[model samples]
Target: MNDSSVGQAGKAATVSARISPAGGLDILSRNEVARLRDVSGSGLHGLLRRCALAVLTSGNISDDPGSMFELFPDFDIQVLQQDRGIKIELTHAPAQAFVDGQIIRGINELLMAVMRDIVYVSTQLEQGGFDLDDSVGITHAVFEILRNARTLRPHVDPNLVVCWGGHSISREEYDYTKAVGYQLGLRGMDICTGCGPGAMKGPMKGATIAHAKQRRRNNRYIGITEPGIIAAESPNPIVNQLVIMPDIEKRLEAFVRMGHGIIVFPGGVGTAEEILYLLGILLHPDNAGIPFPLIFTGPKQSAAYFEQIDRFLRLTLGDEVAQHYQIVVDDPAMVARAMVRGIDKVRNHRLDNKDAFFFNWALNIPLAFQQPFRPTHSAMRELSIRHGRPRHELAADLRRAFSGIVAGNVKDEGVRAIREGGPFDIDGDKDIMQALDALLQAFVVQHRMKLPGGTAYEPCYRVRAG
Candidate 1:
């Protein structure tokens, strides 16, 4: 074992030990183990290290990925292939993950999930196992990934609720999310989220108490994230079932497919990106009459936030888009009842259509939404956020615009790009751009753009209303 002190001035102590998998990731081929250990620039070791660190430091409040790395510069993990299956060797792991020198059981399970997903993606998806060039193939790939992770269960009722919101939000909004989650939990619903703090954590936190009160067991608090954003927004500790998709598009797809209903709380660009993604799909001509339920809710203080979001949707996508979701305010019981009713509708629809309760196979997600949008400066500049296009198509572009801003705000690569260049240049239709600008500015003013009390946020993109 190598002894290396990490943290500033060695103030944060570390631990070294070999941990046996808690069951989910007990086996790996020799080649897979080798890939995880390869420390070259083109290898998976660096990616593995980043994700492992994020899991170890679960419940961290910082959105900066670099800060964690800075705190644990010498931390390392190794996958050992043994006849008895596999073991993880940790070097200078965060002391927080350990209690009395033993890694926390929940965190250990999450760490195994990290290794499981990285190895699975490297061996299955990145290789020629699945075609990623077309829409059908991408959807199939997402299904297979969830299946491998054991997230898809047969013979289960449709009770999973997908909650989308900002990781950075106000205290009132956070408490409101928990209240809604509690209400949902009391009704026997599970939760799925982006797996970060603030809104993501609140619902799961609230649900636990409700589940406990109802004596429910094995309630799933699933968290789906991708490599690009996972470090910035680490998986919250409440996520018992965690799956790391290969990219944001797939991660978003996972949420909609696996969830029976969606409840959106107050959030920033990331939440907007999710709302647009779902709205774009629902607005597609082929998806008309689908029974998926979507709700936008918050404390009474967040009424303006939802209003701005609603106005932005109506202005950009037309009033038809507003039909896709309902806005519920301050009443957790009402939100939960509405969600329960919505899930019942979804279940009946699936039964009538002979669809599986576990996945939404009938949703017509266009190739545009399925395709990954890399928020490069050039791509951001090329986005067409204007009128006269198909409403769904326009919604797709708007989603990309917000997605790029989310990247610039928290994603390491996007942040680096802004530092290297300047804020992303987003120029589009005059009216739409103005609405978008106003919405984003409100997020900044409300402290929704970043975690509360971290650092002052500078604009990541300059919106030009043409």
Candidate 2:
């Protein structure tokens, strides 16, 4: 790494450096390098800059997506072609990413991952290699992306646990997530998350120590994220393997497809969105036979929070929805034990069905879930969160509703649109609307809507009953 530091008269300290690609990526075609250099509004430079900045400033605490850009206004990256491979050139990068005139190895790897994913996905789409129009085609695209990232382990058993929760969680809730993670690590389980702090980081944090205690090596700490959410939930430092999906829908699909099980911790609309996505897929008649272990857990203080979620799910999706998940409060050991048992069943089922251990190909995800929802105001207003429809169908729209709120709360485009057009209006069945409103209100009261020290969270969507 070549490093140069300059402290502007009245700006954040800046560093300029050129670094070779780390292990996650090494080479890029000349065409790819040209595209990376493109600065047009339609090109990849902006996206690359945003994502690379996020990696360079890992462990950032704020939930505001634009804050990093504001802080490092001149931060930029370029791909330089070389006979051997490629090297990255950064101008005014964050100083923290370097140590003793060298870039941190982990940060360099993550930066390469950002480049690898962006180039591969863009090239594939441009060449018509990805079939995004149909359900099967979309699933294939997801698998291809994971394969490109090398996240799929061919011979591994069912052991990855995807933890989903809000980055803005309570101290108590964060500790509880760690406890569960510790127990999971002790049992030889690997960890995967959205790759942010709070619940996402806690489990990985706890698992690290436990893995050490058990003398486990080559343990995987994977973080799956996308361009839109990466800025808001900057990849936590513990994420050794990071995969950047193209969008939120694909990111969620990656989580379900790659994880053997899931554990939901306390979170706001983002967490709720993840829960609804999985439950909706599991509720599909086609997926009823598939066993994906899901558990919702937290400390004793978080009991009321889980109770609220349980009530909402039961009321909206019916009591049968409870069959998909188990709630374990204040018992990290039991949570881990239950996950292990649940995964054993998953292993047997995979063997019987001849499904790949790395990915859940047997699970059926409809196009409605696979297609990206832009979360425009009109889209939010049109969601059919009512009864009489198939439970899975309703769950899909409900997930979209929460997803929009999450965008408004954190994503750059969603935040910009909300500011221009005002809060989204979400309307559905009277009972469903009331339940949704009550659940959101509780999140605000408990300060789960945003990080504790950040500015107050203004509601991004108004709930209406009709």
Candidate 3:
């Protein structure tokens, strides 16, 4: 195998060996193999390798993708065409991914998920004659992505609850999430999340116990991640089904499309990013009557945290935005009960409207929201977070601003940009900027921006009051 390394230090540590794929990605046509192996332009070989490496490093808590690349820069993956099926060829893979010389089955499965999504998106939508120009085309793309990943469950009822939270959280807050998840589990609801640590792992962990007691054998704990954040936040072991989307936009789309309801646990910027994303969509005039349930909950200690988020939302997006989500602190049972009731409404709405339970095909997602946000310096600067226009449109712009902050906080590209230039400057209406700055500063002070006990988190973004 020719040498392949992400950096100079990673060159010598590269390895070359043939490793087989697990379940969903077993068979491969010659054309499919060619698509995976092709490097010049049309192939998804490089993307596949990056995602696979992130899977191989599962359970790692580092939030810096660059560090992982620095350690295994020479790592590469190839899809080999086998008569029985497809085999994975690894070069310079990490030793941690294996135990007693046998690669962990979960890691293998997750790697297959990476390959599954990459190949499907590239061959089917990106180049395979799928029109992505219109709103309907974009929604179709989202549905197709989940379908190929085997994430859609047509036979199942509308009980999948998507949990949105930060990957970095406190011990008490994380424990509270587990408690809430247990209650949701007792009610027989499935779990879905970004599949990282902190609040995401807590609920999945607690649900396992409730599922055991309830004798629910078929439990679905799904994790959806994008390449940019995967290396920083490894997939928790509880994720039975893992799907890595090509970009953050698609990743967010997958969450809103497949899940029946949403739960927001106390978290930092990432959590705020999620909150803004859904609120923006729900605020859209077309979706005003939809029955999606959103909850912001935490332990007793986190009441103030959610309160701050609530106040900021009210200040920036207005009071009507609060009508879309409820904040319930320190009560797991109440949170679960509220979610169950809300989901029941969702079921009835879907039934009445003739929408699919497996995927929310009826939900209106503007192409503006579906298209990827690059978070470049210029793009970040250009975001309009001022007060005015439609509330939903303003919410969308605010979501983009936070998204830029999220990228700067942990994403490799955002971090590199900060290093090359300076912080991303966000200028907006005076009151909004002050409120936004206050919320972010509170996050930093609470040590919510990074994993607790690690190095102090730096502000990658600067908020300027215009």
* Winning candidate number (TM-score): 2
lDDT by residue (1-466, candidate 2, tens digit) is 5645545412777778888888757888889999999999868998999999999999888888888888898888999999999888988888888887688999999999999899999999999999999999999999999999999999888899999998988899999999999999999999999999999999999999999999999999999999999998899999999999999999999999999999999999899999999999999999988999999999999999999999999999999999999999999999999999999999999999899999999999999999999979999998888899999999999999999998888887898889999999999999999999999999999987864256777899999988
Candidate 3: give the clashing pairs: 6-73, 15-92
For candidate 3, the lDDT comes to: 0.83
Which is better, 1 or 3, measured by lDDT? 1
List, residue by residue over 232-345, the lDDT tens digit for candidate 1: 888898999889999999999999889999999999899999999999999999999999899999999999999999999999999978889999999999999999999999
- Summarize candidate 3's per-residue lDDT along 349-448 as a digit string, tens digits: 9889988888987778877778888978899999888887788788788888888888987787888898898899999999999999999999989877
RMSD of 2: 1.3
Query: With candidate 3 superimposed using the best TM-score fit, by how many Å does residue 116's alpha carbon deviate from the native?
Result: 1.0
Alpha-carbon deviation at 262 in model 3, angstroms: 0.5
User: In candidate 3, what residue range of length 10 has the lowest lDDT sum?
Assistant: 1-10
Residue 257 C-alpha lDDT in model 2: 95
Q: Compared to the true structure, candidate 1 yields what TM-score?
A: 0.97
Backbone collision count in every prediction?
0, 0, 2
Worst 10 residues of 2 by lDDT: 1-10
